[model samples]
Target: MSTSPTTLIAVPDSLDTGTPPAPAGRRWQPQATHWAALSIAGLLLSWWALTASGLIAPLFLPPPQAVLARFGELLAGSYMDATLPQHLLASLQRMLLALLAAVVVGIPLGIVIGVFPLARHLLDPVIEFYRPLPPLAYLPLIVIWFGIGEASKVLLIFLAILAPVLIATAHGVASVSPLRQQAALSLGASRWQLLRHVILPGALPEIITGVRIGLGAGWSTLVAAELIAATRGLGFMIQSAAQFLVTDVVVLGIIVIALVAFALELGLRRLQQRLTPWHGQPH
Candidate 1:
């Protein structure tokens, strides 16, 4: 039989869509640096406007310049008995110690709670009861139990950080995809191997997030922790400054705390990205 008459249709080599999908709306998106700078500038301008205009007394809300001067003074010489570096070092030492202890104890306990319902049921009530209590509320008990020394301060901060880390880790571990676990099992993975290769890796992002949150809680509790008869800490310095109505110094202390906490958060974020490089990546 004769084949159907040969027929062909022309096809364009490339569709050549008009505009590239990428770099369209994204190009107009605000850069983080620009937005951060703008926000800082706006806050400073508003602060200056309010204070310089005499709408708010300098005593209550000192001008940014005054706070800056106070910061310089603190950095150059002693604010109270302890110099800026001394106070900062003391605070950092306590925070680091507390954070280390929390991480060590919290991660394993979290894993246990996440992996076993019995553990969760047994421990969750105790964690829940204590987690909501303000650090200040328990400060007295901590001081009485641990004594009003470095132990009390560190212990209080540790407790403040522990609950969040534990909860985060448990949630993260529990949220690990069952498919991933099954895949690991199908590959002849032992329980320990599955935990090491699949479960831990999958839970890392959430654990890191929980650590971030825990750090925040720890910082907020720092002042209270230092309230335990501290002679050298940012908290003590600020408290003394406030008692004496040294608002400039108080403001400077606040700024220092903010800057330090911001640095910590940035550091943790970088660490998390390094550890979980696959996170947030497009397929």
Candidate 2:
């Protein structure tokens, strides 16, 4: 068939190729934001209804409006002693520091151990012993080791965060296919060369996954650490508020932690997307 030149149209490479051929099957692509928004609305509505109906007392459950107002109050420096910014900074600093320490030490050790069966076998039992224990459960020992200052808090957070990173990194390394390793070997790649060029990149996405999850756990541990020995973190603020029956401040602190955690998760997701564009993307 002959086509006229005038009938032809140019399309950019970025343009969608329209509907792809079906594989005699179907899949659902759900938009997460809509569900998330609806969930928030439902929870708020339930809270409002329960409180307004007097079925839930204010002492036990404050209204959403009260919490929202308290959030604003916190931002405006209405709270005493420690300001909102100080608490946020303190928590963020601790979380970041501990997360860094965990990643720096854990990832290397995990990769090394995972790439070698003997190392894994030797260390697995020790790892299991430490991994199952809660950071709080080791509070006394950590205090004794590092004292009750920032070191203890950082150590506790690091312990809480370390296992996930190590586990994830090890799994990533172990999961590298034998085929890839064989191919690299056939290409005359040395042990160090294969590790540097093939294994690291393959394992990076999983390593990032570990880091993301570890950061979250580290943040949680930070709250616990602060609640116990902190003078300036959001957890300390919440603890103080609880003692004074200042539900508003307590709610504010909870919301702050939630907001920060949510923000960190979102940031990490964006980072993952940027780092691993191939992840969950169709060929």
Candidate 3:
């Protein structure tokens, strides 16, 4: 009888072992909110330390306590002919008006540009030209043409907001899958149906992102906008405080502006997440 040679088959480590493989160790990662809170705390601590150490003059950088006191005073009383709430309301109104105008005009124009090469060719140059210029550069021209009235102020912010919205919207529209458009067309989808069902939905995320960016631009331009002979607004308040060397009020205004902008961004981010949960996820 001839002996047969033993044949061996390799097995996976887990199978070769009687027990299952051990899981890899996972490092402990801090939550984003925790990190954010820690960072804010650290910043406040540093600010307090710098002020408390007397290294910086209160004339330049008011202590956090003085700023807090100023905030309370502003809330309870008036400054620059308007109370804090009044000033905030005025700023909010201008910003909202500009935002509405940008959305109404930018979305449609962006769609047209994205859809038609002719529109893009005619409009892209104008947009690119003005988009690069700072709002203050054309402030005098706007004031000259529209007068230093609410029109000029709102228009200034409107122009600041428009380019971002238009560009982002156009990008979003262009990014819509061509295959999806063709499929919709093959399914007897009308132009209106294609836009409503396919393009608009696909582009919404980018549109929101554009609006968020536009909002930041508008806020930055707010000081210049309010410089046009305005009696009330956060920007006006800040400028007024600066001129008088009311460092506390100026610091307070800066803090308020930062807080408001942060709040608006947070709100927009929440809205975006609610509207487009699938956005930014792996397909």
The sequence of per-residue lDDT tens digits that candidate 2 reaches over residues 27-92 is: 344469989988999988998899889887777788888888777766756455667888888888
Cα misplacement distance, residue 132 of candidate 1 (Å): 0.3
Off by over 4 Å in 2: 1-30, 78-80, 281-283
TM-score, structure 3 vs. true? 0.89
Structural RMSD, model 1: 8.9
Better of 1 and 2 by lDDT: 1
Q: Rank the candidate models, highest lDDT first.
A: 3, 1, 2
| Highest TM-score against the true fold, candidate | 3
Candidate topping lDDT:
3
Better of 1 and 2 by TM-score: 1
Span of ten consecutive residues with least summed lDDT in model 3? 1-10
The order of the candidates by TM-score, greatest first, is 3, 1, 2
RMSD of 2: 8.1
- Residue 199 alpha-carbon offset, candidate 3, angstroms: 0.8
- Worst lDDT run of 10 residues, candidate 2, spans 1-10
Candidate 1 deviant stretches above 4 angstroms = 1-29
